[model samples]
Target: MNNDLYQEDIKQIKQQYACLDLTDDQAAFLLRHQNEPYPTHTEYYLNTWEHHDYEDHIFQKILNTAQFDHYLERREARLATHIAFLKQQDEEIKRNIEYKKQLLSYYCHTYVPQLLQTRLQYPNPFFAHRSKIRYIKEEYSNCCKVWKLRVTSQHFRNCRNYSPQLFELHMLDLQLLNIMPDYQQFKADADMPTQTTLTFLLDKSRCYLADFISFFDQKEAEETRTKKDAAIAVFGKAATSGWHIEPLPESNEERSNRLLFLLLMIEKVPDNGQANSCY
Candidate 1:
């Protein structure tokens, strides 16, 4: 692994590749990499001066010359390999970048605006969702529309308004309750309001586990279809408006309860949206 085994060969290699103007460094590179693979650069470097016991001055004279000495054949080959890898994975890298970019755009334009909507003296279906009479809306309207509700988040610097970050965190909490052995008991605990709590759970009866567990799925489908019809009547034009009613992702009892929780929260918001509004 050290230069000891390669000590004798260094001179021989320099002599063989001399036609290519090999330096002591280049000869050492050729001697070590003659096998053409070392898992990666780490493995190749690990077997260098430390393993070889070559004197510091001797080793320094012949270490990694290809980076500065372009004449070294390995330099061109390494660059070519890296460029080829970049080209090969370009599409995947682009998709990943684009996905994050879209998430940021959503955060800026949709999520943050909703949280601050109440302070803007706005009405339901947020002002930001529009552009000069456009019916701007949030992406997911299947559940209790947070933009249409008055939820609070204590974690985010004591925020109190329509907020999706709070909404998602609440959703995970609901999912947690849904998977528990005594889910109803946990759901009940989440329902009971605590003094000084930012969030107030309302209409806890609607979120009863029995409704989802005992009811036939056909009944749920029928209700879903009816809601879709109403949504079409409200925000039908896909070309202009950004909403259409569709099936919620396949959900369990927990998701059903989550939707019920959102609905109850929306219902709890006062009817007087503008008159003496919080904004």
Candidate 2:
């Protein structure tokens, strides 16, 4: 890589590894040694600490004193403890991430869609019309910028309105969907950025949407078949005609976003959608 390009790459890497609490020198060292293979970010951090040169000028000054040898050993012990803590934190973060993925998968495929279907089929005019909601956005930047949303639903006293950051979690899910490895690779042109990547990404997204449609069709058919067959037993030919549910025409992205929004609202106000919030 060219010098400027390498520096940019280093900046990105530093952002990626920032959670490790890397100092400036350590961050630079990581960039320099990145050419060597490391299986994971944790391993890279561990190896960086292991091979770190303590003979630098900064350490040399402290090492020049008679009692410095004892202090150096104590400092090394503290550093070891800090590294262990970092590793422990890394493991904890991984666990939380896996749990988050499981929650998103369940909500996306089952809970959210199920609730949305129910709400669509059985509209609650009273609460639906009366409920008021407010949301605030918190934004941040790192390797990439994104928004964190906090939504509040208000209604009658003692009615459950919000479940803490649920909307933000859904927002995070949408963001993750956009940055999947397959999606990101589809958005890039080899090693460089290009304006044409937008068109390429859209095309790839359309293809994925087509596949999702097929999957949804199969799932929908399987689900309806069982329910409709059961309905026919109760009401005979009347049930055979079905309820004639029709969703509006929309792109895959539009549909997903709408469904997620509905899901978030339903989650915020579980019953009848009625709220009695002051604001």
Candidate 3:
């Protein structure tokens, strides 16, 4: 055969022998002596006797056993690295959540109480009235920002009376209502008929007379209350319907009366129409 054909045949033979369990030196020897004739069977056995000598062989086996061990080690190392990364991320998330919770608790326990106490001590009726409206405006603004952040079209909504103006107006209304008995006696002696009954008059009338405007509307007090009631009816379908009633003490103590009056004023209105006219 030509040199090219001979080379091709040798390549194929080497490929076949590559599948055998032969050592590097043995495969090299076979490739080098491929063109030589085989010796007699007895002489061949004697010449290659060293390969059979397992304990004192010159050439080692070239099996792929260690490759599997190497692959297993790599896999184990990769898994260990991945597990460590997950653990680190989990710990960081937990720490961040705990920090946020502590911050919220601090605000609720300390900041809110201090703010309420300060307002109580100062008792600026005008400022308190204005502050309620400002508070509602800020809350609504915050809700709008939240809606934007959440990428939602729905408007942020709240029913809680956060406005300082409204709060002060309610306080004033409560004070007036508590002194109604005295006002009635004075009016009776002066021979005058009151335009409205104290218990039947809506708190919104007081809000209107005192120039309290809703954050959403700057309309007259009667109109504002009408719109508010309508809105509440529509949106507050899922809201709770119960009066936060607290009994007034049977004492003429000024502090007790003031405390009780304030408590009654701060009590939330029920969802239904019953007692809705009261502050």
Candidate 4:
């Protein structure tokens, strides 16, 4: 073998020996014999030590040390690069988390509300029942009442989900989905004495929308029950009659818009020409 290659092999053997559980004196003895050439086994090294050539052994020691130092330099360089990469990854993860929080805030405060208000201005044909329209308005109002009670960032974050802005968008989407054939049927029924009774029923149904808003509140179970009972009182026996109550949409974007619209309706007051007065 080439001298360099022989030195490298000897360095590897020394490293392996260093990892063993030897006492200091035993290690010193092992190191002293490292450069001595013997047969390939430990038994031969121990048997031949007395007759080993000193000049040849000292030459092997120099080559072994040089090879060991080269290996050490390479290991140190690799470790440094690995540590630097890990730190960069940690910082990137932190930045991504902050960006996500900011995005959620913007959706809650600005984007969702604008979308809801715009959709609410244009009434959907699917909700042609005047009563259903009135119910939508009342539910919107209830959402606003609930929002006003939110106190903390966590509360605000949760309340933001039920904002009327989100609700309005969802309502529009549902209308597009054509999920309101039964509601349309009720609107088409002309045999009823006047549209007033239908309008009254619609208002009663609208009251149940409060339950949906209340669900996001801290006191969700209590408020939901209270609002549900109140809605039943308005509906009376008709509440038990199996009129189709449109299921709430599952999408976060749709639900938020729907809730926002409900809040807007809750906050609005009809003008009685009384300056700055709200009931």
Candidate 5:
């Protein structure tokens, strides 16, 4: 409710959404609808994008969150209902966690102790106490922020390492995660022009997002065609189809950013191979 704090949080929201290449109209939509959930940072979207490392901010907001989290959630606005729904999910998870803590602690002290004593064996102190402690410890493990992270292993090469005004490949996964919904919306609507990465909008020289993505797309296509053509030319099937893409090259970290989004795109797909980029 404090006007000063409200404005400051709004600044954070704007900064977080700045990575996307939005069209004039899409930009206006976000500009008008920017006043929803108040997050200290946008990294949370990285996890929600199915990278499995979602434990970042939810716990901090909900751990000591009994009174405090609700206090912030009470701040009202004519927000995008989707964002509000996410906030509500956070609240529900928080309540469930708090309830689990209470229930686990209560059973750890009371009926569980009595149940252990009931066992006719000499003594089950390990089951009654130590095992219980271990179970509780494992239970709390689920409360962690880092669930499963697979992207740290992957890497990619791009044109430029340093682009201040534009979103680059190294940072694409983070911003792209947030705009996946907008990407779908763009497909359903006719006014938006199709960009390679969907939600991404292009600017002057900041990073021609469509061209950049297509460059990789076409390059991969050529390589696939090249190897397959060679293989089919010889016999029924080639011994190796994708051996050329191997032999990874190294680059400067400070000046270069890997196209982590490629890995992220694969991550979104189902292991059963039933879906094309799970989106």
Candidate 6:
């Protein structure tokens, strides 16, 4: 791409754009960028002079100034195009975030809680017509009503009937074994755990049939926190470069996580002007 024959083109362009008032350094910069597809002033200056052939006066005579001017015009147009693209991308990202937030909120607060209530009401929906199952559902509902009222009371831990076994029994009656492709294996597992009263079994069964509402809610919070970390990492680089980066649309969980990160970082940073002065 480098040829000494472009000297004639440079002379003619130098005469035309004399009023450009470009310094020798600027001229050298323009020369180096003449061949670039989309050059930026920031990139041009950021590179070391040692990396430039013009610093050794190699390009002073042969560089095409007219092509350099065209490059600058093209670079400006390219930058404008990139900014427009970024704005469009940001708007799309914002819309997606809002949609996800709404979905997460609905799943956590309304859909899941109602689903849990439905499960408790008809643990064996397939056999819900039977009088025996109906009686069990009624008794379980009575227990749940009592459990809820006493849950916030001081004697919650002392209540003998507030058992995890109640939850486990309800889960077993849900006919989860029938739904499995390997029903025999699951039925075998279902029979063996007939004696255990561990909370883990209750949690596992609940999670398999219908995930625990609290656990789903916790996962939603964790997802938001992950998003916050990503946003911070993205925007922090823009901040250091003196570019104005827009904050991403965040859920309450995301905002809280972001604030927590900011507070922790602030505490870690030295109060004194000097770096590493915190010791």
Best by TM-score: 2
User: How does each model score on TM-score?
Assistant: 0.24, 0.27, 0.21, 0.19, 0.18, 0.22
lDDT of 3 at 203: 31
lDDT of each: 0.37, 0.40, 0.35, 0.39, 0.33, 0.37
Q: Give the higher-lDDT candidate: 3 or 5.
A: 3
| Full ranking by TM-score | 2, 1, 6, 3, 4, 5
> Which 10-residue window of candidate 2 scores lowest in summed lDDT?
133-142
**Which 10-residue window in model 5 sums to the lowest lDDT?**
156-165
Compose the digit string of candidate 1's lDDT tens values, residues 165-248.
Answer: 444444333322222112233244332332112122223333343433333354355444544444444334332222223444
List ranges where model 4 is wrong by over 4 Å.
1-80, 92-96, 123-279
Write down the TM-score for model 1.
Answer: 0.24
Clashing pairs in 1: 2-52, 3-52, 129-136
Would you give me the overall lDDT of model 3?
Answer: 0.35
Model 2 agreement with the true structure over 16-104: per-residue lDDT tens digits: 65544445565566566666675666213333234334323334443335334554565577667765665554444443344345434
lDDT of 5: 0.33
Give residue 83's error in model 1 in angstroms.
1.9
RMSD of each: 17.1, 21.8, 32.0, 26.4, 26.9, 24.3
TM-score of 4: 0.19
In model 1, the Cα lDDT at residue 270 comes to 22
Return model 1's CA RMSD, one decimal.
17.1
The Cα error of candidate 6 at residue 77, in Å, is 0.6
Tens digits of per-residue lDDT for model 4, 1-279: 676875555566556645333344434455556655655772233211222234235434544555445544654665456545544554444433433333333334433344345445544422455565565444433332333332232322333333333333333322221211123323343335434544454444454444444434533333344434443554444442232222433585444434433432322211321112111
Q: Which ten contiguous residues of candidate 4 have the minimum total lDDT?
A: 270-279
The positional error of residue 88 in candidate 4, measured at the CA in angstroms, is 2.6
